[model samples]
Target: MSILNSWWRALVALIFPPHCPVCDLPLGDEKGPICSPCLASAPLTSDWALRNDTPCDRLSVKGCEVRVVAMLKFHKAPQWRHLIHQFKYHSRWRLAREVGRLYGGKMAGSLFLSDVDWVIPMPLHPLRRMWRGYNQSEELARGIAEQTGLKVETKSVVRVHYTRSQVWRTREERFKNVQDAFRVAHPERLAGCHLLLVDDVLTTGSTMRTCIQAIVDAVPDCRISVAVLADAGGGS
Candidate 1:
């Protein structure tokens, strides 16, 4: 609010104005990214929050329980896939933090999320991370951590090996592909802690399930919850 700080902010804004991530409309009111209409109508998939059973239950491993939640329905009529595509393939890195903030804001008052002890992002293989210059899941987790006052344990888990892209695989193939792909690097960090496992999108829940299985097996007493910006909501 200082005069110099205000002037600097104005200069920055003039240099880089905010725009909507979905429809590419210019933003107003210094509101940051996303316009009002898209914010209100963008295909949010909060259904899992209200449901008792979730996809995580299907990946049940002994000594651990997992739950899933998502912010938007990726394949529904309105279509959230476009946004995710922009984020993933187009280097729309800005979208990750903005979308993460939106999700954190939405869940801010939720009784379920208020007690989360850590935000853990899904990891990309080292090669992929190097090629992309950043991990989208890590970016999203940082934003969520900032808003929710939860610690983000970026290195607590890791991708131990690279696997084929799950895009064209059948559900069974997808599950098998990611199996044993992840390993917890710092299992002690997650011991007995409540973790919110984060990803940019949840397709068949295979990837998250695989990651959750490894973490729970490593830290057998940790409580795990899943949160994604989008979910495909299909069953095998």
Candidate 2:
């Protein structure tokens, strides 16, 4: 059965070659959803190696004492912007997973994430998840878990409210938009566990702030570290 499946996949690839999500270039025999050139040109964050006082330090001021790190700097980089758009909005699940793997591989040896006991992807509202078919954050989290060997706890935290898009919202508006938006579904399950919160992007840190607050409120002893794929400029 495995051999047949491999053969089928190879025949399918020959008929419809995979292309890089960022540049739309043919992937040919490449393994990832991104072509080699696009992957080489990815806008990586310089702070990936930092253990403390990372570029995402400003996130700590938003009511949560969580440490933060992101894989890419999402400004003035057309390739990254395009890749994020495709992964988040175009149902590019493969792209999301591949990007997450790339980021996880880079950060696997980081001392900051070494003590993380569990990984939790920021949840999407039920309606939105149904519409999108899958949560990109969860896909990313799976990739991270694959490299870090951390357990992924997807059910503990959830988005209770369906807020409007934060794309054009002001800083204050963004903060207000996600207010009371998240809830801890099983506080007991998360008590005293060190968590790594995974997200696709960090814009104003509003959504992550609210989510972290919910987790802390439920499990006061639980410590959190955030990991995002990109940092879209705004709100420090």
Candidate 3:
């Protein structure tokens, strides 16, 4: 079965070559959904290396702080944006997980997630999830779990209200869209837990902040942290 699987993979690879989403270059080996050069040359922020960073500061609400780590320094480059778009907007689910796995491995090398007890992916409304077929953040969390040795959590937190896309909204508008949008379904499952929220990107952080506030409000004793594949650099 193992030999057959290898041959099957090789045949599939030969027929449908995988390309690095960031550079649009064909992958030279199985080690990539992203080529090493693109990964190395990409603008990475210092969130993973430092405990006190922009993501942490921006997510602080009412004097309560949320620790965070991110892999990329999101830029305006089309190629860079496409890397996220391919996995998030397109049906490139495997690419999304591979990105998560790659980023998770980097986070594993850092002290950022040292105290985290669970990896919780920001949830989507049932209507939206039905339309999208899969939740990008949940896929990301599972990938991160593959490297971090932490359990991936999905059901405790949920998006109860439907929301419009945040892409073109103003910062204030973004905050408004997510207000009171999430709910904790089973507070006991998360009580006193150390949660590491996972997402694809952090721009204004309205969504992430609201989600964390929901978790903390329901399970007051749970410590909260955040992780993202990229931080687009917005918010306080």
In order, the Cα lDDT scores of the candidates are 0.77, 0.82, 0.82
Worst 10 residues of 2 by lDDT: 54-63
Q: State the lDDT of candidate 1 residue by residue for 95-204, as single tens digits.
A: 78878887887777576676688898899999999888788888888888777778888788999889978889998999889889998888888898988888987777
Q: Write the per-residue lDDT of candidate 3 for residues 165-204, one digit (tens) a residue.
A: 9989998999999999999998999888888898888888
Model 3 Cα shift for residue 184 (angstroms): 0.3
lDDT of 3: 0.82
Summarize candidate 2's per-residue lDDT along 57-119 as a digit string, tens digits.
Answer: 555543347677778866746677788789888888877887778888888878878788889
Cα TM-score per model: 0.83, 0.88, 0.87
Clashes of 1: 2
Give the poorly placed runs of model 3, Cα more than 4 Å off. Answer: 1-16, 28-30, 53-57, 76-78
Q: What TM-score does structure 3 among the candidates reach?
A: 0.87
Better candidate by TM-score, 1 or 2: 2
Q: What is the lDDT of residue 119 in candidate 3?
A: 92
Q: How big is the positional error of residue 115 in model 1, measured in Å on the Cα after superposition?
A: 2.6
What clash pairs does model 2 have? none
Q: Give the lDDT of residue 4 in candidate 2.
A: 100
